[model samples]
Target: MHPSTPGSTDQHVLHSAAQWLSAGSPVWLATVVATYGSSPRPVGSLLAWSADFGMAGSLSGGCVEEDLIARLRAGQVDGGQPQLLLFGDNAAEQARYRLPCGGHLQILLQRLGKDDLAGIQQMLAWLSSRTPFVREVSLHASGQRLTLLQHDSPQTCRLTSEYFIQPFQPAYQLLIVGAGEVARHLAALAQPAGFAVTICDHREEFLQGFDAPGAELRCAMPDTLISQRFADSHSAIVALAHDPRLDDMAMLDAFDTRAFYIGAMGSLATSAKRRERLTGLGVSSTQLQRLHAPIGLDIGSKTPYEIALSVLAHLLAERPQRS
Candidate 1:
């Protein structure tokens, strides 16, 4: 699967459920509702099970999933009503589940009825559309209910004794404004790290031999593509083209966007000259400050791959933290 594929692990479970449903099998979905201490999976991590396909996704590294599957097969969790199961509260239970550092987890298990299937299908649609949303599961005295709320930013999954809310956001994207060796290496590294990678270069020859799996290649002008395709907050724009004509133009366009990270690859002297040129072109001080020139960390990198690693390391540090 592409690293930037939407929904992450939760999406995997949903896809598995859809497949099992299509094959005329009943599916069970499990979500981590809450975690105390050092759980293997975060809140909202998912697992799916069907008699035909066995299981998909995971709730723990191994043992918790095994126990969940065993219990399902033994008819211990057969009721259609949603149930919350706790694991690793005691030393023996912790050893039984092999939870790391005695972590405790609360799991919400639900059988896929007709309505649940419809909801899963809807969630899949939203994920495919790259729409951000929140799935709220309420376990109240009245009954258990699931609701979807539209939102721009994904909220952290949280349990408040009555409700469990898990937010879903679109995948992160990286727009590389060059097809050079550094750009190629960076694209390869970013793709596996869950970035939707796109490489843009007007130089057709440079792009012709580029080989980064799962990255979209664009032969259009870098600046135009940056402005058109990467105006989102979750996007990062990096100019790795050695030519100032290309890199400067892309950086100018990037400054006008909400892209979280805007960077240019160059030496310190080259970056200083570029900054002067950009300032003369009417770029504000604040926007210029956002540009990561001499891009990448000060790792004393010389080779193309090493430079790519440094750039990726800096990007990871600059990325917004999610709860």
Candidate 2:
């Protein structure tokens, strides 16, 4: 897994916690409630620790995990109470946790026992189904108890004096309109970065030769697959077929979806031609603006792998910024 990539670590933590919880183990979940200065992990960052498995995620990018694990082992956080702990707030603490740039992290630790097992399993189900929901944890006035609630609504993650409300967005989905080298490379890079990748192409020969681990390959027309199977708010549709018959149709269909990112790979001249063709096919000028033709950041990429890296970089930059 790419440890520093956004959302990827949270997925890992959730999966690990599910496994441990299924085994009837009491797990402690630590969430980064607030951050001051240049914190390594963002708000809502998670780390799950079980007495048997140690730790499964990261709150800070340094020695903070070690110290937190020590506290858990020493029974400092085992009192069945939700504890709000501060780290790197002072010079000595900063030095001890090795927090870069003197960043400080406020974390909420909640101990989950057998009674919480069903809730954890339900969360895992929601994640597996790519459902959008919010998990709200409110601390009691006595500060010795916390309640977890799940609901569908406007997504948000905020920490107040007595509550922490974290929204869990569905995993980002990437639909590639070709099974070529660029698509394979892109899938390899994107999966580690927390994207659920799907490659759709009608060519049997291309499908036979394509091999990108963890990426689902669909032997169907790009437009058909896109219109029938893909396209959501958290989805990204990329056309890398380099053929108007395929790329144009895919982009046309993608324009109707709520996908945050829609791009097509080509040269500047080729992209202009594609746009003109799309316009001729009844696509509006305003809708055409959403199409990121000549996709990927301008990194002067030449090789297929370099082009893949460029595309991934652009996707990362275009990811929805947390509020």
Candidate 3:
């Protein structure tokens, strides 16, 4: 599956591939097209393959993916023009694929090759630069070829693709305003959920207090740090510190870009005060609307860990609604 966070899709594919290859099995990748009735994996979930076996990201909890892997190893994927794989559903009879339960899913498995490896590499590069890509792959009885297309507005180029289209967006980036305990907690929680998290603070003392795994630490001025590095819609900016100087300028810079979610951590009183200060500094109402002050949802979070969960939950809640 493609993640909005940078590099996670390619990372998962490569990781799964390595795992399969290490076990001396040829691998195939199965992608989900549609889902119904409480499916475990969503539309874009992925399953990796090797000749012997495979591991799926979230496809079918080892039941379906394992079965698919066995079929792939036995050269069973050599049938059907547009193969239809069903899981958790037993309603209709398609001559191609079927599932026992009504949790219907559609999957297409293509054998991996050198060209596929190159395509994954290219997708990884675009993700690293925070670029949105809509990848179209042409599949044959043998292999697949990919073309990378940029994601733009509705008025953008029209696709006349005869091949299948797989859209990939880099994950939302986290710009942690303060590198404190709460920031560390948030950053650590975000990575596996496929968020690329970065912590920014000028104070070495505060920055040194963090040691979150998979988070990028930046001990630089927040404004310049964000301006140089973050400038895309696939980012979420947050001001976590209780300091105006540290959070204000960086958030202002974030306003100039297409960052999807902008938030701040504080109480209702603190948020009101912060709002007044920001208005005094000329932050417009529209820009202010982008801010999620009194950050996180009404989860009654008190401790750092609980606050972190609230913050991430709010992020997920807002993601599907983002423009």
What is candidate 3's lDDT per residue for 1-323, written digit by digit as tens?
22322246656775666556555555566767566655655555666656455364646555676667667657777633335566655644311233435566767666665445555566656756656666544544444444454444221212232444566655667788887778989998998776888988888998765687888888888777777676666678888887878777777788887777888888999888888988898889989998898899889999989999999998888764322
Kindly list the per-residue Cα lDDT of model 1 for residues 1-323, writing each as its tens digit.
01122434567778889878877788888888888888987777788989888888888988999988889999997455678999999999998889977689989887775546667888888876666667776764312334444454336666677776677667678999889899989988987676888999999999887888778999988766777668877789999998999999999999999988999999999999999999999999999999999999999999999999998998889876665
Tell me the lDDT of model 1 at 29: 82
**Cα lDDT of all candidates, in order?**
0.81, 0.81, 0.68
Give the total clashing residue pairs for model 3. 14
**Residue 202 lDDT in candidate 2:** 86
Candidate ordering by TM-score (highest first): 2, 1, 3
TM values, all candidates: 0.88, 0.90, 0.82
Query: Between candidates 2 and 3, which one is better according to lDDT?
Result: 2
Q: Which candidate leads the pack in TM-score? A: 2
Q: Which ten-residue region of model 3 has the weakest summed lDDT?
A: 153-162
Task: Write the candidate numbers in order of decreasing lDDT.
Answer: 1, 2, 3
Please give the lDDT score for candidate 3: 0.68
lDDT of 2 by residue, 1-323 (tens): 11112355677787788788778887898888888887888887889999987688888875998888888889777545677999999889887888877789998888887677677666667667666666667665212222322453435667777777676777788999988999999999998787989999988888996799989998988776776656667789999998789889899899998888999999999999999999999999999989997999999999999999999999989987666
Pairwise TM-score winner, candidates 1 and 3: 1
Q: Could you give the C-alpha RMSD of every candidate to the true structure, in order shown?
A: 3.6, 3.6, 4.5
